[model samples]
Target: MPIRFTQSCPTCGRRVQIRASLIGYTVACQHCNAEFVAEASIDDGSGTTDSPIGVEKIAVDPLMARVEEALQRAAKERTAVN
Candidate 1:
């Protein structure tokens, strides 16, 4: 059986299975369209490597989230009225 490792897509955090032979190979995340190296380090599940363009997770602001929720509520109310 071929050795397989699980890694998360840096851009989307989707799990991807990679073969041992593919370690240090370039791969594209189907879910996020982000390209990264397939570093198949099976220990601790990090499995991240150098990417052409660095991918960083963005932090959502609490104020922005509240504003979005308010907007959604208003839109739903308007639709119900219509």
Candidate 2:
């Protein structure tokens, strides 16, 4: 069975449909260029409880991580010198 979920763009609040099978896959928002992943859960028949089917954690881009590290190092060195 195919699962579906909605995700709101962090930048523009645009709603986007995501397939549960695509969980853990990175996708770019067409409206805002923001990247996100899909997560889903199954609703219990009682309609009062839900179970997490899976989580799609967003992966931090390596290039962005490296740049952030460099910036932190530079800031530390500057502070040490001052």
Per-residue lDDT of candidate 1, residues 1-82 (tens digit): 4445667888899988766556678988877878888764324336534332211111135665565578779999999999
Instruction: Flag regions of model 2 displaced more than 4 Å.
Output: 41-82
Q: Candidate 2 residues 1-82, lDDT tens each?
A: 3445766666787877776557768877778888876544454557432454543222235665575578779999999999
Residue runs of model 1 more than 4 Å from their true location after superposition: 42-82
| Model 2 pairs in collision | none
Best by TM-score: 1
Model 1 per-residue lDDT at 58? 13
Q: What TM-score does structure 1 among the candidates reach?
A: 0.46
lDDT (Cα atoms) of all candidates against the true structure: 0.62, 0.62
Clashes of 2: 0
lDDT of 1 at 52: 25
